[model samples]
Target: MTRHILIGLIALLPVQAAAGTIGKSEQVQACVLRQIDAAAPVADCVNEAQTECLDLVMKAPMASVACFRDARDTWNGYIGDRMAHISATAPTELAGVAGIEVKYDLLQNLMQCDRMIDLTLLREDPSEATEAQKARCEATATALAYVKLLLQSRNLN
Candidate 1:
């Protein structure tokens, strides 16, 4: 009887977790949309979206893995669209800087998501993740720093 009850409880765990995740994802999505609507410029919108998205991903419960993946993909797509616009509309010299800055911001946000995912995954299964996860996280951080440097260089010139 005890074994049966244990199995039953275990079976319900994932569903309960998923429900909680969905609720959190909905909240994050609303926040992202609100920030996007309030932003005055393309850069500001992207930045706000990225920040909110990262916050959501980092804070979401472990059951929200799928939600995190979806959020990352959505944010990446948005950034791609904004990059195209920046390329065509921004001033010639500043266009590259703007694009890099935007990419950096997006990537930095992604790294945060990755870190959260890694930490969550580790909590669930510590021995299974590849070393590459850490490497990717570090590389993204470095690249983001370089992007900042490029923006600063452009400003100084």
Candidate 2:
């Protein structure tokens, strides 16, 4: 899992450098789309989109969460479609194993992010910003959760 995270973080480095001078959503969208051709990890692609989106609206927590909405939605789409895809493609036993693994990933992702949000809310004066932060964190958790399933499915091919 740590290796997966490291690879994902490293994969984003070049995209991040290239995007440093890009300030428009159009440009960011283009760069993210180009990641497939570049053969970057999908986690990197999703993280770049969310990070850049958040950076664009860092001053407003709610707006930052709004920026994350697209990434969150995209990840949700991936998660939503993946199980059926796996079931249809893999041998039944492999599909069942992958299902269990993906479920574990999903649980770990949400629980860890929830832990963070809970910690934030534990502060004496939690506010709207705290809620917004929670939303963004959930977005990020969802964004990162699907990479393992994605890689696993690809190997099934």
Candidate 3:
């Protein structure tokens, strides 16, 4: 009985570390950033946003949920501004260029990141989010990475 209890306690330790206290904020942030950075390339935007949102929750487990809620809204505005510029210019600048399709594809991918952010980050609550939602957020981050890479290739970033 004593050994069984010890084993049970051991099993709970990782969970406690992951979702327990604000003192664990740095650990939580590192874990979340790893998750976001490791996401598969070109994954869905919502998945990326969800992963980030949930990670923020894990980072500040005891902080008010409203902060995360507000974060998404604020982040969406930033992403929206960047996306708006691409949307306004892509149709014109992307025209008749060599490899235009690739450029357009990358542009669309970035725009999808914005939409996914809206659906996952802005609209959802991290505390109650499902695995699927988190997956969408991870996807968004992945797509963002790819877009960044593309932009850098063109000296845009």
**Candidate lDDT values, in order:** 0.40, 0.58, 0.38
**How would you encode candidate 1's per-residue C-alpha lDDT over 80-134 as one tens digit per residue?**
4334444455565555655555545545655685777677786676431323333
Between 1 and 2, whose TM-score is larger? 2
Return the candidate ranking by lDDT, descending.
Answer: 2, 1, 3
Poorest stretch of ten by lDDT in candidate 3: 14-23
In model 1, the clashing pairs are none
Error of 2 at 78 (Å): 0.5
What digit string (tens of lDDT, one per residue) describes model 3 on residues 40-157? Answer: 4332333343454456555554332443333333333333333334334444443223133333444465466567656765556654433333333333433344334333333222
Off by more than 4 A, model 2: 1-43
Tens digits of per-residue lDDT, candidate 2, 57-142, equal: 55777666655655555555555455556667767777666666666676677788789878876774676576667667766676
- Candidate 2: lDDT over CA atoms? 0.58
RMSD score of candidate 3 (Å): 19.3
lDDT score for candidate 1 against the true structure = 0.40
Give candidate 3 regions above 4 Å deviation: 1-64, 93-157
Name the regions of candidate 1 deviating beyond 4 angstroms. 1-63, 110-157
Best by lDDT: 2
- Full-model lDDT, candidate 3: 0.38
Which structure is stronger by lDDT: 2 or 3?
2
Would you list the rank order by TM-score, best first? 2, 1, 3
